[model samples]
Target: MDKCGSAMEFLENKNILITGATGFLAKSIFGGENLEGSTKCQETLFTVKSSKRDDSFGTQLIEKCIILIVKVIGKDLFQVLKKMWGGDFDTLISEKVCLVPGEVSLSEMGLKDSNLVAEMKNQVELIVNLAATTKFDERYDVAVGTNTLGVKHVISFAKQCPNLKLLVHISTGERGGLILETPYKLGESLNDIQGLDIATEQRVAEEKFKQLEESGASKEAITSAMKGLGLERAKMYGWPNVYVFTKAMGEMVINDVKNNLPVIIIRPTIVTRPSTVILLDMLQVTVGYATGKLTCFLAGITAIIDLVPADMVVNTIIMAMVAYELKPSNKTIYHVGSSARNSMRYIDFQRFNYQYFTKKPWINKDGDAVKVEKVTVFNNMTSFQKYMNIRYLVFLKGLEFANKVFCHSFQDKYNDMKKKINFVMRLIQLYRPYLFFNTIFDDTNAERLRMDIQKKDRETETFLLDPKEINWEDYFMNIHFPGLVKYVFK
Candidate 1:
């Protein structure tokens, strides 16, 4: 079949319901530059719930416009508007998209209006469950409620949808170590934990929380315990973090309950923007005058960063959705990542970061250029610790001594500086695993889908899914980094 014909056949007249529509991944899928003005689907329903209690009409309108601009026109355009005139542009996307107030964590997606829920069930053709807590150190109760039991609720809702043809579950490629484009069964022990069933698990988790509360446990103690439980449970299940562990369980639930329904599991690894949260935090620390102009410290960190641009991930998702819809599959798992196709090590990413900052040094409030020096790279933790002692700890001690000897009143300031440095170190320790991650996701299925697209379709379809086509250095330098600086860093 021709590309246009294939796309039309798959997406024409389809009503897609996306959970977590406000999230990074879903926004990329529906509002990516490639899909802009080329969305073949008839209508998209984004499920959302306002955290604000007194949300006014003006607030809603602004929220809607922001969604349209980011998910539709892309952030680059939004950044352009802010940069050009310090003004905003309105969107015409409301005509094609509908925002339905709902919460995925609740039953029936927390939709209070039964009629609206029924209407959605009757008309929705595709259901994409992208709602989940992505924080690695998320609390156990929250993670299980949203990521584990939430999948069950979505599956139940999908089963009720009379017109449902496809149900896509967005999972993490980092769940199983060295992910392969194949079915993975949780270990027997992990399976046993899952066998407790969603309801039972939810009850158990809640009861644990309640028991801790009744025991008069401190909030910090309870939080630490919950976090530890999540980590221990994840380790027992052979997963790395709570985020991936719960996501894996969510997939398991779908696999067990899908029952002949067409389902596609898209596992994407480290789906990042031009600048990731870590990079942003690092920049905030190292680019300031207080950090002694350490621009090259990030470059010294040696690790493999298996990252795929958010745009690339979204393109793959849209194409996969269309391809799977055109040819129904009982269950298909696609690894949409760059590790197996075009991998960029941490060192390379650091080099690009250093190069970018070196060319455009951050100007401090004092109107002085803060330049970065070449950093010392340490491979082992021992060496890193030794370097930290010599570079920062010793310097801090000297400062403390000077304050004590000369300016005794500056003790508070010296203590504050020490705390800030320690906090930064803690942040680095928290992100140590991801900074040094080495897992490679096998994207065989995703690649085959890219190749399967008809030449005619390839020409007409704006969204390209091939990871091999991506140029990492160019994308980071030109597209990603600039967007990050303008939109996020600004």
Candidate 2:
């Protein structure tokens, strides 16, 4: 379908409701022109404002943006925005941005303000659902509540908005091997498991909760049990972990319940933000190695690791939103990742990490340069497990007996070592699917959307959603690694 108007023209006087304002992606959306030194984003905003659309359009953006954030992260949510605008931030917020405290997991999005809800229903033209629990091993009940039921609630809310044009749901591309830009059919799963019902899954989680409660399980025990249950359920249905499984179910909910409302699902893979948490597993491990804590790595060294800049993903979302507004669709899926167009291998990433750290070694608290080494890589799980057994597991087993003879003096040390090992093993299990991932995110639909934007003159040129343009080596060496040190590690 061909959309008629430009993004600027379509967005004119629009009221947008964005859920999960506390999230990194949502914040980036709010930042708009003030992202990651993106002068292009700034230029685009000024260009749009300067355009001769109308008297009001030239003075301010079309969006009267509303955001929903939980109290936990809402305390400092606007600090960055405030920094960007300084004294004028409050005035700008008063005029354009509206902050609402709520939880998407609850019915009506936990939005209790009746008058404000009424206002949103009357004026909201677009809805972007960015609320999600990204923990790979999150509790089953919690994941479903936010990821699955959350979408249902958002849709229910959208149905109330008389002027709603489109709803954009931010999802992840975690399904392995040639992931496509296609909608998930209700009850259909990656592993082809039958009877994969959302209602059944919800029931299962609730029943498990009841069982734990009846057994007088402690809060910590319940949390651990629920986390294991999520992974268990996910693996049973052919997914790797809790986050992706629940998110996939979220998409299913959209397909099942969206009764003719325009919808777009954007699946981004391993999105990296400058000062925010980088979603890639390798980067976390690399951090350990950089600090001289990790000596070996487990991964399919040759496997392709999909990576995309967060700003690029945001740009794609914006383009998709405008496209949907111009040409409404019942459902459309876009895989906004680099795998299909520009792929990076784990081996190359490893080399880059080594090169970067070796050249500029980390300094310890003692003011000495920590030495570096090329970590031994294991291509298979068996080898990795074997290595772990030989290297540390055997010693821990012996330490179990030694603790009894030493008046339990070594008990604390043994416990710490065992706990660290368990944690590492758990992390490895959860991340193995990605570390050895063999997938290509097909972005044909995304490319078409880019082409559509391209045809409408270069005004939309600043939205650089194309992954093929990125130089991976240059980006990691000069941009990603240094940013990690400054913003995250430091």
Candidate 3:
């Protein structure tokens, strides 16, 4: 096949049903409002910076003028055109791409329109199941209802689809154990519970939920009970959390129902915008004024963070979909992560943060520059808690005591601060496990697929999905960090 033909043929006229169509990956694929609000300023800044290389003000001026024109024309018109043209802002939106609005957790995927569901069953060729509850501490009932039962619904729908070619179910990279490129039977390992079938396990979960409901527990109490149940089940099953446990159950459902059907499970690790604090700091140091040193201490400084840019993860999804189409497989599992290919050490990440902050301080909303003197990295939880207690907790407690004694009205403010501190502490506890995670996902299958595409297709066709081509430092400093600051922090 020719380059373009090979790359676009599979997706070309293939009716696809993307469950989580409003999510980040779907938005990038279909085009949506990811670049609004404070991002407009970042967009202008990026344009001006690009023009600097050519030493030309004309390019910058033109971009600014275009921005003004866009404002006058309104954002809605621009968005319509952008969506119609797709990501490149040139190619027309694939005629075959159609949005199916429904909830995955429902029986018929929450499809109110029976005709639409029938049409999907008749016409849809590929079903990309990306809908799932991603919360780490989600309640057991909600997690299983959405993540586990949701998969069963999708599979039932897929089974009805006469032309169904592939079912791409998005899973997690962390399966609470060493993950291999090949698919392994559940409970095959020593740590896993033996002979715990999905049907029996699901029944047990439902029975427990029913008992809780029958007990006439308060809503909050029921929720807490469910959460506790999920944690207990996960621990018993050798899974990390309710989210992963339910997701694994979802995969098992697919395995059971998807007889003789082509299916691929993609397990993606921490998907986040790259940290750009260092790059922004560098820019400030080089272009703006600096202030005196200020010290900042951070927890999880020596932890290892396995993260892949959201765009990269999306790219892998699309490419994997296409690759599966080209080479039909009964079952294939791909670990879409950067750990094996391009790992970033937490200590080094912190170092970059320190370097950036020390050189150029962050500007607050009030236009005051915050200086950075030094940063202390806490690898151990004990050290982190000690620092927090000495630096913040003790001081805050003193303020609270004074407010209670002298200024009773001001006590509310102190209470609010304490609540905020408690919130932060809870978040720290929630994410602490991931910060020190040591598993490296085996990506042999994914890498092989990339190589196959590289050999068969032109560089332009495969460049975006090529994981080996990523430069960790460059990507973090340029694209990831800048994007995070502009879109998220803003």
Specify the highest-lDDT model's number: 2
Candidate 3 ranges with C-alpha deviation above 4 Å: 2-4, 32-99, 175-178, 184-190, 195-219, 273-302, 388-422, 459-462
Collision count of model 2: 0
Q: Which rank order by TM-score, best down to worst?
A: 2, 1, 3
- Per-residue lDDT over 1-490 for candidate 1, one digit per residue giving the tens place of the 0 to 100 score: 6433755466667899998877767766664455444444677888764443457644654675576455644544334333433332233354557777666777887766677788899999998888889888788888997898788789989999989978888888553257677654533233344453445556766888898999999999999888767776676655667787777778778777778777888888877762322121223433342234443243225456677667666666666777775676543888877778778886776577667767876555587766765555566666777778887899889888989899576788788989988876766664566766767788878777777764537553445566677777877667666655554543
- Model 2 agreement with the true structure over 1-490: per-residue lDDT tens digits: 2443555555556777877765677766766442323221211110000122233521233321211323222424346665767787655555565655556778887665588678778878888888888999999999999999989998999998888888889998667667878888888878888989899999999999999999999999999999999999999889999899999999899889888888889999887762232322236776788888888888898898888877787888888887776666543898888888889999998899899999988777788887889999999999999999999999998998899888898999999999999999999989988889898888888898899777764667766677888888888887777766664553
Weakest lDDT window of 10 consecutive positions for candidate 3: 40-49
User: TM-score per candidate, in order?
Assistant: 0.81, 0.87, 0.75
Pairs of residues clashing in candidate 3: 275-481, 276-481, 294-372, 294-373
Candidate 3 lDDT over 156-267, as tens digits, reads 8888989888888888745534668765454432255677566666777788889988999888888878887887777676676788878877877777777877788888
Off by more than 4 A, model 1 = 2-9, 39-41, 50-91, 175-177, 186-204, 216-225, 274-302, 388-426, 454-456
What global local distance difference test value does model 2 have? 0.76
RMSD of 3: 11.1
The deviation in Å at residue 222 for candidate 1 is: 4.5
* Rank order (by lDDT, best first): 2, 1, 3
- Model 2: what TM-score? 0.87
